[model samples]
Target: MNNKNKRLVIPLLGAPGVKLTDTTLKENLSDPFVQFKTLYKIVERFNPDGIFPFMDLTVEAEALGLKIEFPENDNPSVREHPVKNRDALNEIKRKWKGVSERMITFIKVCEMMAKEFNILKGGYVIGPFTLAGELVGVNDLGINVIEDPDFVEEVVDFTTSVIFEYAKALLETGIDMIAVLEPTAVILSPQQFREFSMKHFKHLSSELKKPVIYHICGNTKHLIEDMGKSGAWGLSLDSAVDLKWASEIVPSDVRLIGNLDPVKVFLQGNPEMIYEKTKELLEKMRDVDNFILSSGCDIPLGTPLENIDAFMQAAKSFK
Candidate 1:
């Protein structure tokens, strides 16, 4: 699609009111029918150009035998790092079953969304580096990347294999696009990002039949150019990024999809405030033809529907 003329507003709205609440995530995610109904409700309420099925980053880790704790109000989070040593990592790789793992339920949801929803259907996978962090613990992974570069590479390589298989399955389900969430890569320098994350991302992007949107939270000012080199069709940025600066540096072909503060603007603001903020952002990015107005990241739980409505209205009214 020509994003230049379309003005797409594809905010990440996987919070309680729009999608499934925490109470429903465990019960609903496992059941395709319930997941479809939940996703349909989100599509109906938001009327977005696309539907982003459950943004839980823990799905990949959980599939690798890591334990996850589902909180009452928040997204599920990984509770353990099963691959603590080389032996453990090798064991995981040996036993890894892509389609039959815990993530199968999520793949089924994507299939349901693709077949049932008329709008663009999108699926998400935690980026390989990020999934590696879940498996080995972020702190340990960081230290190991410097103290034991070989070990880090091996772990990330295994994760790349896991993500590739999982992404391939999602694509087979007919989703229009896939989003790779690489929040862990935000801590790496540009060169480190290229070596550890971008390479694997390029592999995924090249292999996937559908377009890939790469997202990294926090300030990506240093990595914008490198991020464009990852072969993704679009780059989803966080609120810490300056869209104008990013637009200037990143290649024009890579569509830019964010920077709106999900918490301050969507969760706390009133409709009028939300509309004004939306208009402000629209004006800031007006010159960037490939820009798609979106929340910097997933809209948090309890964000007001009226605020979201105002955001859409402002985008629609922008001349």
Candidate 2:
């Protein structure tokens, strides 16, 4: 999407940074020093066309006062859903100051990455529906969507405001792109996705005026049409999607950035196998110019470094 390279190679890389730097996920996430070191090591080793910080979805939710549990090795998870009603959400809004320290830590890391790296630097923000799910719990949100549509709209609107502010902070650091993590919206029907997620995504992408990469995990083939209309410059899809098939449906200008199975191709397979799989994907997409080869999602922790090398080599060597 950046157009700096004919075939850009940027995996949704994060947890692997911890594994590469010999630091725990908690340490790298909390301290910008640890965060920068991990990312810098990744760039040095992999030489990716673009680089992004750890894709921790909990940053925005935790900042909004949700209970979060952080494990040493694994990514953090939201533990408490305190907003049971409209009044509860209003209370949190009334007391809101700004983003928390961890959010600032990520922004600071972006600043550091901006100063040090010449390649494209990216930032992450949790999508509106996903953050709302964290606040009210996914089950209640789903039920309210059908039974109480107005309430669901109000909650989503509030979450969008919160995300907009956070996105502005990330953009201030001079990052090239922001990927909105909207994994929760994967379960919604196409119409529901357009109504709830697409509307707010358009707002963020338009207001920021930066290349927004819409990233949703799992099989997103059902929602491709709405996602293409969300004003995103690119779509970062998961392994379940067929990139060759999606390339036909997605808009001509929008770049496609994934499909390689992170676990199967990068983690479980050896280098030779990884090379063949990466090459296979490359061959399928050779006719499409707006394509960036990447892992379907974030490369899992404990993935072998050599396998990553094979993926990069395959992309670079392809005609």
Candidate 3:
């Protein structure tokens, strides 16, 4: 048994971090290469099978001419909402050059890592509605969806195409998977999810033949069926969702991951508590197969390493 070609064994993790799109880390995202390098190190330390690093939130909106302001400590935030009018869409180039220095640099890191380690190479990207949120602002996009249906549809479709193309490019890079993060979709009613979010998301999933993971940070119990229907291979849930009920809702064919309280338990709980919580959840999953253990959301950066070790210890024990 040679070591180089070996497939490493590791458990899934709810990738943890600060809300970069909020107020920290944004200052450094201006240089995508530096951003990728920084994020990769943190991910490599965790040693998960794959990771969606911090570079996800900015590229699409920034490319679309949104005024992105970076702060010293956080991920980049959108300074100017780009979709004030339909004309602004032109600012985003339709063709993917695979040569955008910023975009290509991220891929180069993945290629480099794939050469060195068997770990999966991956990253995140804003979903259509989320990207649209950066464009029209969250409240404004909601208003437009009801007030101007045709315009919202047009914008969503355009953004959806870019999401698909950009993600398609990443999947072709020999990486294991890409998480299509449609965080805004969590706010929609389940019906709205079926109508607006699921449609394009389904299309996006279909176009990317590689595995896709969807993370909607909310009580996603009501939307699990739609998630299954959307063609995503897996769904990441917030801690608010019920684990037992979710296992029943998700189709057996599609793997369901998560609902650990990332902040309450992982951030504040002790290792024994972490072990207890993980043991309880894993027991709940006893009746189901195809479930990957994970946190409901990104594990807080300050999460106790002991708790993390305890959680992984439980996973490694799984037969």
- Model 3: residues with Cα > 4 Å off, grouped in runs: 1-46, 90-101
Candidate 1, 175: how far from true, in Å?
A: 0.8
lDDT of each residue in 195-253, candidate 2, tens digit only: 88999999999999999999999999999977877899999999899988888899978
Q: How would you encode candidate 1's per-residue C-alpha lDDT over 89-174 as one tens digit per residue?
A: 98988877765655788888888887888777788889989999999999999988788878888999889988888888988998
CA RMSD, predictions in order: 1.8, 1.2, 4.8
* Model 2 pairs whose backbones collide: none
Span of 10 residues, lowest total lDDT, candidate 3: 1-10
**lDDT against the true structure, each candidate:** 0.84, 0.89, 0.67
Candidate of highest TM-score: 2
TM-score of every model versus the real structure:
0.95, 0.97, 0.83
Which pairs of residues collide in model 1?
none
* Number of backbone-clashing residue pairs for each candidate, in the order shown: 0, 0, 13
Q: What tens digits encode model 3's per-residue C-alpha lDDT throughout 1-319?
A: 1132222222333223233222234423444445445545545555555555454577777656557676665445788775666676554444333334345555665565555556555556678888878877888888887888677777788888777777877777677777777888877878877767788888888878777878788777778778877888778778888867877777876767786888898889998888888888878877666666777876765566667778776665655
For candidate 2, the TM-score is 0.97
Cα displacement (Å) at residue 250, model 1: 0.8
Off by over 4 Å in 2: 1-5
